[model samples]
Target: MTLNSGRGLLAALGLLAMAGSLPTFAIAQQAGQEGTPQAVPVVVAPVEMRPVAGALDVVGKISAIDRVDIQARVEGFLQDVSFEEGGTVAEGDVLFRIEPDEFEAAVTQAQGQLDAAVAQQSLAQVQLDRAQQLLDKKVDSQMTRDQAKAAYDSAVAEVKVSEGALRSAQINLGYTTITAPVAGVVGRAAITKGNVVGPASGPLTTIVSQDPIHALFQISETDFRNLRDRASADPDNVKVTVGFSDGTEYDQTGSIDFIDATVNQSTDTILGRAQFPNADGVLRDGQLVRVKLESGTPEERALVAQGAIIADQGGLYVFVVEDGKAARRTIKIGNTVDTDVVVRDGLAEGDMVIIDGLERVRPGAPVLAQPAPDAASSGQIPAAETEADAAPAAADDKG
Candidate 1:
């Protein structure tokens, strides 16, 4: 062969030798020729079994169980606002007062009518007794006695009617003073003093109960089913906890009280509600919070680094080194514990999950696996061999 062609062949052979002898080591970083596939170096961590508490997290909202809209029950000019705006008030406390002059006049008029009726009935009773005594003494006819009895009965009926009207007047007068039906924090008065308000004037203010609060959250349909099934077997109490955006957790835990009967077709989720004791008024209405729901006893589960997970159209997956090659393993993941995610399926203990150098990896590609620094200290299984001793030997042979 010509010298030029012979030299070109040796150069190609040396490149091939270097590629073939590339070692699996943490520090090795190399690529093959234009069309040849080469081993990709990556940091791996073994799948571990961890004690998981089976906690599910979701965004929730806080609200009050008893929210009352305060409105005037009687029609009158508002004479006074008795309570401060945005302050706490007790039950039976007077919140507002309407003009009582008209109501008081009505009550007086009713009382006078009742008194007049009672006086007429007293006169009718005297006349009926006189007619009856005269008839017995043969001084009056039976017709005269019958007429007196009818008049007396009519007066008695009138007195009863007047008594009912008086009671009605008293009730109307009582309505002029508005009182709180519940002990709670009151909102700003919608109608200030001197404004005319009545039953049709809408709410004058709103009050929401503060001691016990409620949290509402959504759960996926799939997760809802799993939880229901587990509940049937376990029958244990499910605990609820909440945290705020400011990195503070609620001092009290809540209990699940309700789950919606139907799922939201648009989101494929169902609503779940929990009630908590919020004595300090820490839980307010319409506050967004993080809710964690836990149940059953802790169980050992396969866990992998959360950073290793990847998502595609099919679902979540991770790269694992199997028999010196990178393979794709589809995984069904559950709740997160610390920095790892619980793997429901598709992985087992001792499986080396690729956590670093994933950008250079492909399905079925040969990979040089090395334990991540943290994983090594945590006692992960050591790699079969290292490329620390491979590259130099290949170079010497090429020389």
Candidate 2:
């Protein structure tokens, strides 16, 4: 019995020694794990709210309300183009003068004849009066009185004929000078000095009325109906602003003045015109421009930085960080402005978005969001790098 007990004690001692060696083996495994480094951190931003305005925009053209082609009215060699090409002129301004010396001489000859006729008429009247008085006193024959009366009448007719000739000559003389019929800025003079021009001749120049200019644009019937409905419903007036082809907005605002009564058959578009006070004459006729037609009461809208939008196989999307993980979200977008886009759906205020290091993120990846290092320094990021993306990624995880 004593021998058996001694063997059992020795077995228990060996088992204890093996258990101590097992702890050292576990320590080596733990040391190896501690040697590796952890992943780097990512930055993110919370979803923020901003205000936007509702607007309707379309491409339009600028035009002069009144455009005129000036034609020559007098027959003569263009003595002098009194106004410079592309100069402003007023009504009754003389444009050109024809040779008038021949017409003047004709008038002088008519006047001389009229004077001689008057003198002859006076002498005939004296003779007629003397003959009449003699007849009254029975001192002369009736035939003699009649002859004097006939001479006096013939002299009066000669005087009347001479007066008619004088008036005709004077009128022909006045037709020599041509004058401006309207006030406006004149275009290139088609006829120069010494060029023969007449009433039958073609246009001499063109004139465009610059003040109270107009902007012309066509919109579909659907758009027109929308505008009309708004105008009728609201008491406030509809306003419009214009932009040039190069994306510069004009400094003026215009009101809708004229709308076509019927839609165009071929185009199905309604013609509309807006007037502006272009006193400086900067807006030219037929220049292309973009017009924003705003109607109804303005409403507040959700706007995101333009840089925050992303595209994928599905559609436009953005990334947001939530609970320290990246989440992807799809968004419905609306009008885009200078550096922002109006979001019609799929986003809200106060959501955290991932803007920086988007490439390092994936759906459901763990993230450590710090103040986006790049974002803190610069607020203007590319569309892909805006907070709208990061906030959705962060907030989407909650949904």
Candidate 3:
């Protein structure tokens, strides 16, 4: 019986030893499984520095410098029209003619009356002199002398009145022809031949000066203030460039010609005007255009891919790859150019920023850097690579 009990005890000891060995073997297998290196795929873009200019592009319209409404100054019936519709004319060019026969006849009648008055005055003067001589000889009475003097004065007054009438008739006759007041392009005439036009008839046509033009546009209050401040710093720096609706750029540069004193109450925008030389008449009045207000010089700033930025609770941030790990960094953004953004702060040139797989990246995540595909390549970013980057670095080691 003692021998059988000793053998049972030995068997129990062997079982306990096997159990200890099993635990060690399991631990060794787990460590071996964790020794493999796993790569988490990610997309990266090189940081580039570029020039950024602070400017605001605004929409505007073109307008002529001088606009006039043509009207007749004197009352007359239009006898002949000499100007073609939409034709260019010079100052003092005859545009219309009124009938001058009545005016000329009035001048003739006034001249006849003045000649008769002059003859009567001469006779009256002779009568007065004769009366004075007879009074000296006591042949004429004082009453006759007074009568002759009165007749002479009346005749002289009539001559003066006729002369005045002749001058007025001449002026009226000259008013028969209508001439252009200023040199410009003439629009369609509102009145035709036989139409009586005068000051009361309003404008007979419209004219606009096209040698020089103005571009009118509105900008936000903020932009206006920025422009003013920049101008104040450097008196001759701010320049305005204009572009047409068809995307063609204007060669002539313009200066700020006008600024409204008061801001527009309804739109909160300020009205601005720029003067441009249009000697060739290339710019027309009331043409809609785009204005680029360049307030200052270009500034060197950091640039990054526009898609690399991610917005969340941390605000504008980018995933920077450092030491082969996904690092989240906040950045200050400046002006945007095409598909890239200018960084004012929080980034340096040549920093690798993740352009793809942002959804799978987080702080301290392990990332396998990959070049962004060129435009010629297929545009698909693989889903498996995205999933791998989303997993933890420790998980990568375990795999």
Best by lDDT, which number? Answer: 1
Cα RMSD for predicted model 3:
12.0
lDDT of 3 by residue, 1-399 (tens): 699999999999999999989989999998887765444577776677777677667889998877888777668788888999988888889987887887789889988988998999999999999999999899989999999999999999998998998888888888888788787788998989998878898888888888778999998898788877866745246677787655567888888878888899999999989888887777888889878777666777788887888887768999887766778889988645556778888998777788887777877767877667651154333333343444555465465
Q: By the TM-score metric, which is better: model 1 or model 2?
A: 1
What's the lDDT for candidate 2? 0.74
Write one digit per residue (lDDT tens) for candidate 1, span 1-399. 999999999999999888776664322433223234566788888899988766788899998888899988889999999999888889899999999999999999999999999999999999999999999999999999999999999999999999999999999999999999998889999999899999999999998888788999999999777776655533246778888876567889898988888999999999999999987889998899988887766899999998899998999999987666778999999876656789999999888899999999998777777778887887775545223422333344334
The better candidate by lDDT, 1 or 2, is: 1
Candidate with best TM-score: 1
Q: What is the lDDT for 111 in model 3? A: 88
TM for candidate 2 is 0.57
Clashing pairs in 1: none
Residue ranges of candidate 2 with Cα displaced over 4 Å: 1-53, 102-175, 233-236, 302-399
Residue-by-residue lDDT tens digits, candidate 2, 1-399: 699999999999999999999999899878766653322256555454555445667778988777777776546666676787778888888766777777789999999999999999999999999999999999999999999999999999999999999998888778777677777788887777887777788887877778788998998998787877876744146777787766567788888888888999999998888898887877888889887777766566766665567897899987765555667878888765555567778777655566667776777775656565544566533334343444545444434
TM-scores of the candidates are: 0.65, 0.57, 0.55
Q: Candidate 2 at 83: error in angstroms?
A: 1.6
Off by over 4 Å in 3: 1-61, 74-76, 117-160, 194-196, 217-225, 233-236, 257-272, 300-399
List lDDT for all candidates, in order. Answer: 0.85, 0.74, 0.79
Model 2 clashing-pair count: 23
